[model samples]
Target: MGLTQFSFGALVRTRWAYALRGSQHESLLNTAYALEAAIDEIVFIFGPILAAFLATSVHPVSQLFVPTLACGIGGAVFFSLKNTVPPVLEPIDVVAAEIPDAQSNAVTGQPAPALQTAGDHAAPTPSPEDNGFRLRRLHRPYSAKPRNVLTYRGILPLLVVFVVFNMSFTAFDVSMTATMKAAGAERFLGLQLAMFAVGSCIGAVIFGSREMKGSHWRHMVMFLTLLTVGYVVFRMVMGNFLILGVMEILTGLCVSPLFATGNLIVKDIVPARSLTEGLSWVTTAGSVGTSFGSTIAGAVLDASSPHMSMMIPWIVTLCAVPLALLGWFLARKRPGRGTGRATNTAA
Candidate 1:
C-alpha cells in the first residue's frame, strides 16, 4: 500500500509538472494545485461514506474494488493525453552542438579570434572561455553534473518544514478520533473529519483563484502561522462537539494552500532535471510525518488524554515556524537561487 501510494503521488506530481511546463506563471501553478487538492478533499469527504456503505451492504473486500478500478481508469485516461506530456530533453552534447562556432569554441576548450570590424578599431570580442561560460549561464541554471535535491540552498530547511508541518497536521486526525471516542460520539467522527475536508476544498478554490504576490517562502510562513493559530483554537474548543466541528472547518482552511505553496517552493528551487525527484521527496516527507504523527498521537492518547493529544499539533506547528523562517532567510541570502524557472528535462 505504501509503495502504491508513493508511486501514485510521484507520478501525479510529475504529470502536473509536465502539463504546466509551458506556463510558469505562479497563479496558473497555484490554480492547478488548488484544483487537484480540492478534488482530493472531495474524495476524502465522500470516499469513506461509500466504503462504509459497501462494507455494510456487501463484503468488506468489495470496497477495495472501486478504488482499484478508479486507479486503472484514471491512469489510462491520464496517459492517453500525449500532447500534454513533456518531451524528453536532448543531451547536453546535442544542445551544445546547436551553439554557434565562436561560442562552441569555449565549450571545446579552443580559442577563437576576436571579432573584426570594417574600421581600424576592431571590436573587442569576449574570450572563447568567457563566451562558453556565458552560453552555459544562458542555457541552464545548474552545473553539468546534477546535484542532489537536498544539496540546494534552502531546500533542506523547506523539507524539514514539510515534515513537521505534515506531522502536526496529521496528529489532529488521531486527536479528533480520540476526542469523539471520549465524548461517546464515535459515530459523528466521520462527519467532523468531512467538515475539515470541505473547508480545505473551499479554501483551495479561493486561494487558487487569486493572484498572490511576494516570495513563496514568506507565503508558506504566513500560512504556517495561520495554521498554528487554528490549532491553538482547536485545543481550546476540544470539549464542545459543535464548536469543535466549527474549529475543524476553520483550521482545515489552511491545509490545501499550505501544501500548494510548498509545491511552488519546490518548483522554484529544484532544477528542471530534478523537479520530479524533488516533488517525490516532498510526498515522501509528508508520508513519513503522517505515520510518525499517527503513532505518537495514538501513544499519547493511550497514555494520557485526548486533550494532551490535541496539544501535539500546535506544539509541532510552533516548532515548524522557525524552520520556515530559516528557509526564508536562506533563500534571501542566496540571490538568484530559486529564481530560475525549471524547463522540461529528460530523466
Candidate 2:
C-alpha cells in the first residue's frame, strides 16, 4: 500500500481520496513525495558507495551494471506488491466515468446533482446520444477527451521553470568537471558530488521531519532563489577546490527541498482527474531540461575557455529565477494554497 498507493488510486475521486471508506490520495501523494525526495538524497551517495564495493573485484563497466540491476530488482518488487497497483477498470467502465467538476462535468457537460432539497425536481436520465456516449475501443489515448489539466493555471510555466533550473544544474556540472580538469585536480569530482549529496540529504531530512505548514509556492520561490545563488557561486569558486567543494554542498541543500516543493505545488493546483498525467509531465520537463542543459553546456565548453563556460549556467539560472517568481505569483492566486489568511502580495 505504501509503495503502490499512487498507481493504485487512479480511479479514486478527490472526495474519495479524503473519505474514510476509500483510499486517501492526499496522504498517498504526500508519502510518494517524501520517497522521491529521499531518492534524490541517496542517488549521489549510492553511486560512489556502490562503485567502491565493486572496484575490488569487478571491472568499471560492471560498476554501471550494479545500479541498473538494483533498479530492475526494485521495480520488480514494487510491481509484485499487490498494494502498489491501482485498481483496473474495464474499458466500458472507463468510458462511462465522467470528468467530475465543481459544477459541470467535462464529458457529460451537465451540472452535478446537488443535495436533495424540499423543492427539488425529480431527476431524469439522459439517452446515450444526449450524454455523448459512443462505442469506442481502448486504443484511443485518454487525452482525446477534455481533461481538467490546468494549462493556464501556472502548471506549464512551472514545468518550463523546472526545465531551465535543471538546465542550469547540468551546465554547472559540465563546467565544474572541466574546470577541475583545467586546474589539474580531476579526481575531486566524486568528493564534490558526495559533499553535495550529503547537504541534500540533510536538507531533505530537515524539511521532511518538520511539519509542512507554509505555502508551497513561497517555499518553491525561496528554495529556487537559493539554488540560483548556488549556481552563481559555482562559477565564482572554480579556481579553488576547497571553496568549490563547500559551495557545492551549500548549493545542494536546496535540491531535495526544491523538488519536494514542486511536488507540493502540483498536488495543490493540478486537478484530481489529471493529477497522474500532470505529475508525469513534470518528470518529462526534467528530462527536457537535462537535454537542453547538457547539449548547450557541451557547445559552450567547446567554444569558450573553461572559466568562461560557467556563463551558460549563470544565464540559464537567471532565466529560471524569473520563472520561479512567476510560478510563485500564480500559485498564490490559486484557490487553495494551504495558507488560510490572505495578505498583500504582488499581482
Query: Each prediction's Cα lDDT score?
Result: 0.78, 0.66
Candidate 1: stretches off by over 4 Å = 4-6, 22-26, 91-145, 335-347
Clashes of each: 0, 2
Tell me the deviation in Å of residue 176 in model 2: 1.2
TM-score of each: 0.80, 0.69
Worst 10 residues of 1 by lDDT: 338-347
lDDT of 2 by residue, 1-347 (tens): 22433432222222222232234333444444554676666876777767966875787577878766766787567557665334432223345634345555545676654555667677455555544555652344543564556563778788988798878767777887788787777776767667778778777776766645566767777787787787778777778778878887788878887776676566567644455666656766876898898888889889887777787776876787778778777766767533212322223
Q: Which candidate has the highest lDDT of all?
A: 1
Most TM-score-accurate candidate: 1
Expressed as tens digits, the lDDT of each residue in 140-203 for candidate 1 is: 4344667789987788898888888788856898999888887899998889878889888988
